[model samples]
Target: MTLTKQHVRDVVDIYIRAWTKQDPDLILSIFTEDATYHERVLGEPIATHGGIRDYWQSKVVESQANIECELLSLYVDGETAIVEWEARFDDLVRGIRKRMREVALLEFDGALIRSLREYWASETIG
Candidate 1:
């Protein structure tokens, strides 16, 4: 199926919602069974649904709170979507409030994300 801009937006909305709500399952729903998620530019990707679930469970659900994510911009071409976003959250593990700016490249398999690569920078605000 040809990917539409609205489809991309809907998926992105779900991603933001999942993060803000700290719902690992919701985030996982948008990915393919063998999807690869690159949380950092230079880090190894977390592959497959189970790996992603564990990562999200620990990093997002367990260690982050009061999360907020905003979609700053998005561009879609063929089966790929590139998005820029800003987020603010309390880092439970680090004991600091953080503000992050991120850009992600999402490659889609139909409506699900087959691979995601993220580049981001963050600073402690408090």
Candidate 2:
């Protein structure tokens, strides 16, 4: 299956919307039952369930204010989508606000995502 621009937009919107304290179940339903996601900037031996939940929970807890992520670019081919994005938050590592660029590769089985691998820059500046 291939993703169209609408599909990419929908996926991005779903993620951003989930960040706004929406129903966690709605967000969880967007992915496949066995979906796998990795945050290359941190963690190891993590998959879905605890891994993904911990990642997002930590982000919200770390930020002093609202954490925001925006879509910069998105490209899809075959069953995979590559998303280039930016996010702003009170850095949990540094305890200050900064922006960082993240690039992610997402694979979908039809409309439901199956796997996501995201990479972020190690060095972030204000």
Candidate 3:
């Protein structure tokens, strides 16, 4: 099935909500039950909702990182999409603010994301 603009918009909204809230339930709502998530420079891929929940909890919610994202571009073909985005966050762990530009390769199951591989480079901000 072709991925519609509405679908991309919905996914992007969910993505923003997930980061802004850092709520596991809200994050899980954007993914299929058996979805997979990977951050290229990070550790191993998380392949279950429970794993994703834990990952997000430790890395985001528990750390109390405030995140903001800007959607740069989105390209869709069939059930897959590539999204370019910029994110800025306070890294409580490192005691610094950071900015990252990332591209996410996403595979969708209907409106939900089934697989997301994110590639990013982060810079420390003044």
Whole-model Cα lDDT of every candidate shown, in order: 0.95, 0.72, 0.87
Best by TM-score: 1
In the range 1-126, model 3's lDDT, one tens digit per residue, is: 567977887878888788877878898988999999997637778988998899898988977487888889999888999999998999889899999899999999987889999998999997
lDDT of 1 by residue, 6-107 (tens): 899999999999999999899989999999999986888999999999999999999999998999999999999999999999999989999999999999
When sorted by lDDT, best at the front, the candidate numbers are 1, 3, 2
Please give the distance, in angstroms, between residue 88's alpha carbon in candidate 2 and its true position after superposition. 0.5
| lDDT measured at residue 95 in model 3 versus the true structure, 0 to 100 | 93
Give stretches of model 1 more than 4 Å off: none
How displaced is residue 7 in candidate 3, in Å? Answer: 0.9
Superior candidate under TM-score, 2 versus 3: 3
- Error of model 1, residue 108, in angstroms: 0.2
Q: State the TM-score for model 2.
A: 0.78
Q: List TM-score per model, in order.
A: 0.97, 0.78, 0.92
